[model samples]
Target chain A: MGRWEPNATDRLVVAALELFETNGYENTTVIGIAERAGLTKSTFFRHFQDKREVLFGRSSLADVLAEGIAKAPADAEPLEAVACALELLAQDVFTPERRDFIARRQAVVATHPELREREALKGLGLIAAMTGALERRGLPALTARVTAELGALALELAYTRWGSASRDFTEVAREALDEVRSAAPAR
Target chain B: MGRWEPNATDRLVVAALELFETNGYENTTVIGIAERAGLTKSTFFRHFQDKREVLFGRSSLADVLAEGIAKAPADAEPLEAVACALELLAQDVFTPERRDFIARRQAVVATHPELREREALKGLGLIAAMTGALERRGLPALTARVTAELGALALELAYTRWGSASRDFTEVAREALDEVRSAAPAR
Candidate 1:
């Protein structure tokens, strides 16, 4: 039977988060992070290009969301397709156990302008991923783009609240999406 | 009678765009940009925080857009307030005479990942500006946020199309807004 094994990347993320919080993000170094994670600097570079990327964790979220959007029911509306993907993210990406890490990551990014800029750019990429995924489902390009924009806003709100909301991330995301859809006027 | 005088900031932008395009972004430097513009390196730093900031200009766009949104008719809808601001931008910020510089800046940014990241984050700021302005007009927070997202998309599309569209930027922006509105569903 397969047993749990240590992941160098996860170890690096945990170490980086702690160091970034305690020593301040600007004061933290890649070598320091690697040492804290019980690995070498080269091992750290192998996992992440830089310290800033440790919190982003590559492009897995986009892949997960795209796969979920593609798997949505055929009769689903444009936003519904996005909703399906968000639910997947809540259940898988934003699991209860990872809430603390995600919250800590948000806090670190919030205080650092450089991290905030990177996070904002990362958000644009997620929107692009969602838009492209929806287009592959045969939705009109504008419809897909618009839905993705709204979905990104909802996703952003959910991420901000996931750290402290009383309800689960799933419920928060659903409410966020509803709030977005309510404000969006019908054609 | 007043005579036209050179603006150091404008000269720097022109020089930066040319250098970024010809010498490549990475190879270009503040000294080179200043020399190309016939200004001192100190002058360049005085005008911009860095080379990337030169391409983005100051926070004038946000201020202009916010002011425009505030000046919209009292009865204007949330998106209409955004539209009014866009029209003002087209007339003032994205005027025909500045189209070439703006287009070149866009091309230069498209070629550089660093510049694109800066541009993306700047976009978030614009969305924030629009949202706050809409809220000031008495729109609900969610309504303002959602409209700003849609409006930001339209503004992005308009900016991309501004250089070569047969119509003017103002018309382009208006049409872009209409396209966004059409795709958005009525409440």
Candidate 2:
């Protein structure tokens, strides 16, 4: 709790991110992550199936995104609902305290192909989550999916800008979404 | 050629898809694919690094799409360039003779997580290719990426329709692209 993590999972993730950044993702092992976290090998195994799972945590962003979108005002449109979810992410997940570590983790992921594949799959999962959330709000399937892809693209853009921009994640994400809207090619 | 292919690579892809569908993807192996193709294990290795690599062949969609866009009329818009590329795919890759096999291959991929991940990464590759192609046509980076995403979404929709519809791939893809444009949220 002292370092902002309430459980062994965060500790393990933090330890793994450091080791991955320093020693390389390929060189780091589950046993090493466990030892670094001051936890046992069994604890690491209990928490994750493998080292790659460490980078993607047990936080379950799909659930988070879903919950955030669900909480948006009843009359909000699809993109507006998506905006609500991104704002919630800025508040809860992408906190100021975690920004440095998040940037570091991204750098580690960028250099590894296996990690990139996992990241891509995770992105698809997020988009699916947003799509379902939008559909539940009564948008048509195609509109829901298109809106979700745009939201996901904005999230990707804001993730890159969050650390660099003077603005926080919410504002950066808003700007990104606006950029997507303006840049979107008219048929 | 006995079938449509004059080379070993196409034979291996066809053989691998058959084996993956008959046996589960997890249960299939490189040796099995080789045996099914009537080629030696060494030849299979020479053609592909592994079983998963067989699904993603040396016939890269990125190169094909890029080449098609490059061949489009200089006055063609980004989406039009994408249409030209999809039309090229209809002519060369998604021929009537290969439709059944293509559908079979897609089904095999849908049920497997590893294959889905590969497909998602492959999709990212296609989007990147489209982005680069659009950028070379003088569009801005943001515009290029957004246009490419729309194109990719349309391509995805058309893929689900190509086998089921009475029409050929070109018409289906064009309609899908139009659907994407209309379905796109007005922001």
Candidate 3:
């Protein structure tokens, strides 16, 4: 069995974010990040392919969201399923400490156009995952796709709001989900 | 006034798409596109700053939609204003021939990750414009942002449906708008 390296990936992420904020993303190298984290470069590579991956890569994020959607009640509507999924993600994946890191990372991403694009792609991937889950639940293709996109948008809004204060992520997320649902025109 | 060069830009776009499809985006060059279009390289530079711009740049599209939104009736809701703006874009910007080229360009973008990122940025730009227009219409900040995102998502859904057959872009766009609005969970 491998030795326990508890929070190894999280340590690398925090180290990378600190270096990125102090030295800028372009100037911060993987070796520097690993050293700052008191970890080896090989360990860094094991957790992330490169420095940018340290900022953007979170494969488990999609898995958490998709699993949440899959575990929603069988009779839930497509939008409700998405809402449940995001709420679960807010509760399970994004703890108070991770929220702080995410806010800092957002600030860094805003400064660089390439990072912004990568962040946008990550958002799209989340939406795609949610869409796939909804499709498996037998919603029509277009409905599933639109609900997933709305869910992503709500998450973004909630995260932005949550970053500015000490509000609960779940409360902020529910408010965002409510905002989109209320804005819909009468059928 | 300078001498007329009617359809100069259109010709370049067609040539670029054809060459991108035939030679691949990486292999295609500005010189090859100009030659294929029976135009000078100087003329190519006049319309597009570079080869990739031919596939991605269209500044006037956002202008058309924003203008349409601004001209909507004063009493129109934020989402209604967005729908009006998108209808104008579908009618004024996306003619049948343009749709054909757009489809080809979308296919090319699908083949390249870099192009896909550029495409996503362009989509973000459109949403930003719509959001700004909605804000001007007196909607709250978050409402404007979310509605604008939904507008962009609707346009994307409509365009995808339109590409598979000969359909009215306005009708498809409206249907997408309707679908999302109807799918909203009850308050």
For all the predictions, what are the DockQ values?
A: 0.63, 0.61, 0.38
The candidate, 2 or 3, that scores higher on TM-score is 2
Chain A of candidate 1 scores what in TM-score?
0.94
Q: Quick one: ranking by DockQ, best first?
A: 1, 2, 3
**Residue B185 miss distance in model 2 (angstroms):** 1.7
Global Cα RMSD, each model:
3.6, 3.5, 3.5
> TM-score ranking from best to worst?
2, 1, 3
lDDT tens string, model 1, B1-187? 2233379877888888899999999999999999999888887887789988998875388888898899999998887888899989988889888888788878889998888887888888999998899899888988888888888999998999988765688899999999999988445
Cα lDDT of model 2 by residue, B1-187, tens digit = 1333257898899888888888889999999988888887888887788899898875667877888888999999888999999999888887888788778888988989888888888889999999998899888998889888888998888888886766798999999999888877675
lDDT of 3 by residue, A1-187 (tens): 3355788898999898898899999898899998998888888888888777888786466777788899999998777887788778777876776778778988988877778777888888888898898888988876787788778888888878788768778888888888877764455
lDDT of each: 0.86, 0.86, 0.81
Instruction: Compute the interface RMSD for candidate 3.
Output: 2.5
Return whichever of 1 and 2 wins on TM-score: 2
Q: State how far residue B107 of model 3 sits from its true place (Å).
A: 2.9
Q: Per-prediction count of colliding residue pairs?
A: 7, 0, 0
Judging by TM-score against the true structure, name the best candidate.
Answer: 2
Question: Can you tell me the DockQ of model 2?
Answer: 0.61
Q: Compared with the true structure, what per-residue lDDT tens digits does model 2 show for residues A136-162? A: 988888888888999899999999888
